[model samples]
Target chain A: MTKNLSNVNQIIAKYQGDQSALIQMLLEIQRENRWLPKPVLARLSQKLGIPISQIYHIATFYKAFSLIPQGRHTVSVCLGTACHVRGAPRLLDRVTDTLKLNPGETSVDYKFTLKTVNCLGCCALGPVMVVDGEYYGKPSAKEIEKVIANCD
Target chain B: MKKLQKVTLTINDREVTAKEGMTILEAARDAGIYIPTLCYHEKLAPYGACRICTVELSRNGRSRLVTSCVYTVENGLIVKTESPKVIKVRKLLLELMLASSPAKAIQDLARQYGIEKRRFEADKTNCILCGLCVRYCSEIKQANAIGFVGRGTERRVVFHPEIASTVCASCRECFSLCPTGKLPSETDGVCFDDLTLDDFLKTQQSPA
Candidate 1:
């Protein structure tokens, strides 16, 4: 927060502080910071001349932005209709038990953040999980555990 | 001046005439029919959120369920406000909403409809993620302080920490519009456990 406020300003300037670019701006902020801090959002709102509430609205509307600190590796289990039908629930259970964290919660040590997504748009690869933007299709419990172990 | 054109439609078993622009819900109300709604407000613009006002429409050899609050009337239209299919869908929606908030007002309404238990998993907390407060702030007060964020099951009402930290006590307009009392409090207000029927009924109509 002490230094990234300026970084957020640079991203806002790159977007020309346009109101319509709010989503992209936040995405960039998330890209740089991995999660959106309240201070960065306030600074962006001030620079962009948009209401803070409206900015929060946009931030919350999208699943990409995180309001709090996120783990280095994010585990999103696809619970979409296609994945669900293909046994995503079992994958989710296995992942959560191994990670010792539930959806919407980061581990106490911040090693991982687990979440369940409606779909990851890879229906053919039912029961998928993504870690740091890398997709693992048809992941089994032992495979998911090994993947997380290697993420450090 | 042009006369107001009327559309003749059948609601339930009775023939009713309503203005061409009037919605089916309004037309049914004009014909003395009752339709439960969660998001409709006379003051704010129509938002078809709860889907409880859904009714079946049959015309031209086709039948479909449309939310009466938004769907308009047409000539020779047949409407069944309480069709079995409509009830089944409404019950499902109500169960989902009940799982989220379990508000007394909503529970009473559901009980009247004979719904007993939640059929699906409850994935959310109170507030039901309805946008009534967000809409009230934006449209009515123009405050832009709160809003709905995310999509699908992750959708929820989010507040501006800076603004909400200070302005909540002074401005409570959204409190009334929120069907679930989760907003505006960590305790007290319309939260089910905060008070009882006798205390609440003292101020408003008793649902029981």
Candidate 2:
């Protein structure tokens, strides 16, 4: 617990303990820790003099922050307007069947987190599924299986 | 000391003088005019979360609805607190709130406006989300123990267990400020594991 807390102290020090950079500090913490643990948030609230309630408010407000632990690999299926018309739903089904996890849920083994995004800003790559920063446009079920198997 | 500036404006065709920077609601109330409101508290800042205090403001023949709590008074601004346009908006807002909450305060206002039935499908979370309790806890008490979490339809009040467990048992000042009266009764702390308000109270009573 103390080992994890020293990293939190480093992140806070990087910001020079500025109160206005609360959101930025939290995002960095989330990136390193995979989630904002309650103890980390409480420590931030104490050091910054901002209340824990306020920190929790910011944590839950943005879609980027995660209060709970996320998986090692993030699998996001684009459900954008272009993708919707071009078999995004079918693509999502294949991913879910392989992962056995619904959208916004992490796998029981913590291997992958499956979530749907409105857009990945690549309309040309309609029905795109991004797994661990690698994008596949309209990938087959076998390809998805290979992708999941590749991730340790 | 700077002198308080005054401005004159028409409310329901009655010419009234009000202090400069005072809201239209405050001016109307000073003139003994009635404007219904659910989320306006004198102590708290003007949130304008509940649009029940919406009034029609007409200037130079251009009319639009504005929440009286947040809108500051201006010269030559014709304010209508009970116009047909204002009534229609307030009624719809009341209907939306009525569908979500069965609180006595909302029901009483609906009755006053003759809102007999809610047209929308009931998705009652029993929280109108007027944000009174959250704002009061942050602003008045300076103890940001309770606050809102999530966004849009998922948004609801939550009492932070770490802070609330220490500060809330004795200082539940936001309890009386809640219009729904659900804060005290709803023992569930809404989020942050299974920690409830009762648990907080228990922690306080047991002494360390």
Candidate 3:
């Protein structure tokens, strides 16, 4: 699917073309376009008067930026120490089985992007599975299915 | 121009005088003290990426390890290039580098440190992530055609195909800066759309 992406100029302009706010501009662009296209990076390089290689460096360095297309929903499973002891791996396996998408991979239909995070800083919610921002604690397979089913 | 202030320091029990802002590596090099380095180049800024130049620094009876390439010289500072701690750090760094790059420079360093083999699994990507090519392009050449991408073990050097195709042929300065020689070998790889420097030059030579 093609996104209009005309708003990319507006996003860059919002930051007043400040080189320091490169990450901020990228984040806003990612939020709007779901991914950073090559042409978009080239456009950003031209507009900012910065090198395309430098922009590519920033895009690839941060975990927040996605060079490839991302799905509508972001499903993250915490695999922190606490979550690990609470069967987070098994929970991740269940989610992977349900979505048929491994960590760092998006679904073909653009429904979900499954990811495994080291920690969410919520130790109380061990083995936490978060979809779109809603956190679930040690959810069973059925609960996982119900949550995924509700997304689309 | 204001006269550059000098600082006196002890390196390997030898008194050495250096400019105030000079790094330990520079001071040592000037004083004829040999300290092995990988990611350090005189033309480029002190990156301190490769820890091979790690040295034992002492001040106020306190000693700690620091990369000499970026660490500035100070009055009464004692630097040890081949201390037990520094040797261990260099040895381990050499071993780790040997696993990935095992190139001439790395092998020579490994041999110096008595590292026969690396204990870690060999993942020979050849490119040591030294940033020489990247830094040379950006700092010296100001071309910015190549740069480092990703973080940690996932990090690698990549070329901007658009910029490289335009600037790299006439300016192959970075080709010689690479310590591991990955640049020349990977020039025709997917990054340049399978276009070699010779191919680029040939196309340039051909009439339109």
Q: Score the docking of each candidate (DockQ).
A: 0.36, 0.44, 0.32
Task: For each candidate, give the TM-score of chain B.
Answer: 0.82, 0.88, 0.89
Choose the strongest candidate by DockQ.
2
RMSD of each: 7.8, 5.4, 6.5
Per-residue CA lDDT of candidate 1, range B57-145, in tens?
Answer: 98788899998998988888899988899888888888888878778868987897899887777655586655788778778877666
Q: Candidate 1 residues A1-152, lDDT tens each?
A: 67799898788788777889989888888988778888898888778888776876677667787777878888888889999999988888898788888787777677787877787788998888998889999987788889999999
lDDT, residue B166, candidate 3: 79
Q: Residues B58-86, candidate 2, lDDT per residue (tens digit)? A: 98789999999998998888999999998
Question: Which tens-of-lDDT digit does each residue in A1-152 have in candidate 2?
Answer: 68668988999899999999999998998878777887898899899999877888788788777777889899989998999999999999899899988887877787788878889888788889999789998899999999989999
Model 3 C-alpha lDDT per residue in residues B1-208, reported as the tens digit of each score: 8898989999999999999899999999999999999999999999988889999988878999999999999999988999999999898988888778868988888888898756888876787888888898898889888777777776767777777777877878877777777777767522533433223223322211
Clashing pairs in 3: none
Fnat, model 3, is 0.51
Q: Number of clashes in every candidate structure?
A: 3, 0, 0
| Cα lDDT over the full model 3 | 0.83
Q: What is the TM-score of chain A in candidate 3?
A: 0.93
Per-candidate TM-scores read 0.70, 0.91, 0.92
